[model samples]
Target: MVKDECKTLLDALNKVSACYRHLVICVGGTSDSQNLREELKKTRQKAQVLASANKNKLTTILKDKTISKDDRAEFERLWVLFSTCMEILEIDMRRALDLGQEFPLNVPTKHLIQTGMIGRTSAVAARAISVQNMKYEEGNDIDTIDLNELEQDISEVGEMIFEMEMKVNVLQWTVEAKQEPGTELKSTVSAGASSLGMISVHGDGNKKLCDTNKVFAGAMFSAVLIFAIVLAVCIVKFA
Candidate 1:
């Protein structure tokens, strides 16, 4: 029975190894490799720390007299699995960093900016605005306005900087959107409509101005027409 249990444990370990091998093959040369390597490195570092803290834990478990041989085999198999996973994870981390260095913008930076703690103009501006508003509220005199308020003003200036940054981002998005078929068509149509609207508004304003000028010129035109008519009537009455 002990032999059979050991065989079963070995079989399970073999299956685990096969599954891991397949996963490695399937994940080959993919972005996950770098990520996995980093994760493995971290995991190994953590494992080392844990092992140092509890140096006797493995020996204690192995020395348990009540633990069946099969149970021991199972535990060993699990350890192997853990070790393999950690190694793979480390390899992935290295790969990821290399890829990042080679293709810097392969990963989108927007998410990082959105979630980042510092260096964003929007965030800086917001902080500045808050500080300035606080100082203004605290009754700081004009010449002696609080430093805090000045800091806030600096932060508020970040708003314009942030806006310019956003415009650049939007321009990039627009260019990319134009490359897409449907989006390109939509943008073209929208632009046409906007241009037409602008023209219509300009034309309407010009027409109104032209009409006013014509009204002012109307008296001169009418006087000339009436004079001609009166001269013809006088000639007809005399003849």
Candidate 2:
């Protein structure tokens, strides 16, 4: 009976290994990006199904008081393999997605240049207007700002904001997983170690995740508000 569960997990890991090989082919530029993302979506769904169906049963086997020590050790060994393979699958998916990369798009060079020019021009105009309103003299200026440098800074901040948002989403999932009893092992299988998997199945972890998400929300809101204000000012000035 214990061997049966181990076999199930091993089969799941084998499927993931096959999926990972296909993912590598997609990531190697032989396949289009859309196909790559689609494959990942499908893989995630399969993982969710596999975990949902088997996770509780596997846990039951391990936590049974009458389970033999040898069986327990074998199950643990297979569990580790399954967990590590799932983690690797998730990492490769994220890499293919370029989770924190700028733009995450394949826009044409011409369009990108045109957009950058317009934004840079509008930003400079907005800055000039603000400086003028502040009554800064030509000879004794308060500060000089470079539009290119400012744009780069804003882009970096935006990327950081996006990364924070992703982490917050993972934290929320972890908290919810803790709140549900049967979902603990399933969540670990589906979300990998960096997300719902590594989180403790404890109420304290749930509370801590919630608190951290709240703090992240407040900080993210402030940053997004500031960016929105700047963007609005540029739009108004340009218009």
lDDT of each: 0.41, 0.47
User: How close to the true structure is residue 232 of candidate 2, measured as C-alpha lDDT?
Assistant: 100
Please give each candidate's TM-score.
0.23, 0.38
Q: Which model scores highest in TM-score?
A: 2
Query: Candidate 2 lDDT, tens digit per residue, 1-239?
Result: 65785687568645754564454333323232333333444454454445434444555665676878667665555544555455555555455344313222253333222221211121222221232332223343111222233244334434433443443222222222213565669766666755544555665788998999999999999999999999999999999
Give the Å shift of residue 47 in candidate 2: 2.0
111, model 1: CA deviation in Å?
19
The runs of at least 3 residues in candidate 2 whose Cα sits more than 4 Å from the true structure, single-residue gaps closed, are 28-30, 99-239
Q: Candidate 2 has what TM-score?
A: 0.38
Model 1 ranges with Cα > 4 A deviation: 1-60, 63-66, 106-239
Output the number of the lDDT-best candidate: 2
